[model samples]
Target: MKNTEVLEERITAQGCTEHLSAVEDAIYVIGGKWKLKIIIVLQENGNIRFNELQRNIPGISARVLSNELKDLELNGFVKRVVHAEQTPVVVEYISTDYSRTLQPVIMALSNWGKTHKRNIREDAF
Candidate 1:
């Protein structure tokens, strides 16, 4: 029996619904086209300013990044720090402790993506 065989096993309606609900909730939180991308960037870069973030994530507009950062901050996954003590105010965004909890999920998805691409390439040959 292979991993795919186990995946094909029939599940009960209640069990299916429960599993779907969990996935749906996950999608709701990290579902946006840019949420996970933003999280991954912040996690890797540590603390970065708005302009830097915009530059790091190609094709993302300032307006969209602003919205996503606001949402991440609101959700407590990212922290925004504003430094007004200097001549020019500075603002930086960093992932929160809670955000670290997502590392395993991101790594798992990354591994799956790599495997899926390899499988597709193999099937094409």
Candidate 2:
């Protein structure tokens, strides 16, 4: 079955469509591979310049990083500050308080990932 149909069935089975929809909305905002990584880095580093952000996230193209940052900013998870007074303008990305709400979710995902990896290794043996 298609993913949506599967999700619908799961929602129906669990009788928690509202919760599922909220999760879908959360995923829509921060579901991508780069979005969460960028948020985590920004949260850790406080404020980072464009090039510095790109360097912190290896393997992300400049274009993709730009797009992701825009999305995160639009979603209120990140703030883009530009300083034009300097001879060379400086732009920085910082995580917003809204992004801190995802801390529990991130921790849960991290713990689950570790458990999943251990389970997979055990199964492989």
Candidate 3:
């Protein structure tokens, strides 16, 4: 092979490795079934209580929701606010500005999901 071709191949391989590493990091932070869903709900609702969040995403148990919230908070995608002045302490979860960066990704996934469902239905018939 030509020297130029070898150099191009090396660059391509390195690019692919970098891309894969970035994707892996993103997945590690937000790969779970409930994490994105939780973010979506929080973004839509602004600030919501724990019970409200659980209700918004059906099928998520309190334990799982709690765990996911903690993960999101740690990742800086979510803000947990506590209101102490109330007779009983009230806590709410809100999406951080940083989480807005995922809006495009979420939209892309939503569009792809719709298309996939339509294709599946057509194939079924």
lDDT string, candidate 3, 75-107, tens digits? 999999999999799999999999999999999
Error of 3 at 23 (Å): 0.8
lDDT tens string, model 2, 82-103?
A: 8999868988889999999999
Q: Give, for candidate 2, the lowest lDDT window spanning 10 residues.
A: 1-10
Q: Tell me model 3's lDDT, rounded to 2 decimals.
A: 0.93
Which pairs of residues collide in candidate 1? none
What is candidate 1's lDDT per residue for 31-71, written digit by digit as tens?
A: 78888999999999999999998898999999999999888
Per-residue error for 68 in candidate 2, Å, reads 0.5
Ranking by TM-score: 3, 1, 2
Structural similarity to truth (TM-score) of each candidate: 0.88, 0.86, 0.89
The local distance difference test score of each candidate is 0.90, 0.90, 0.93
Clashes of each: 0, 0, 0
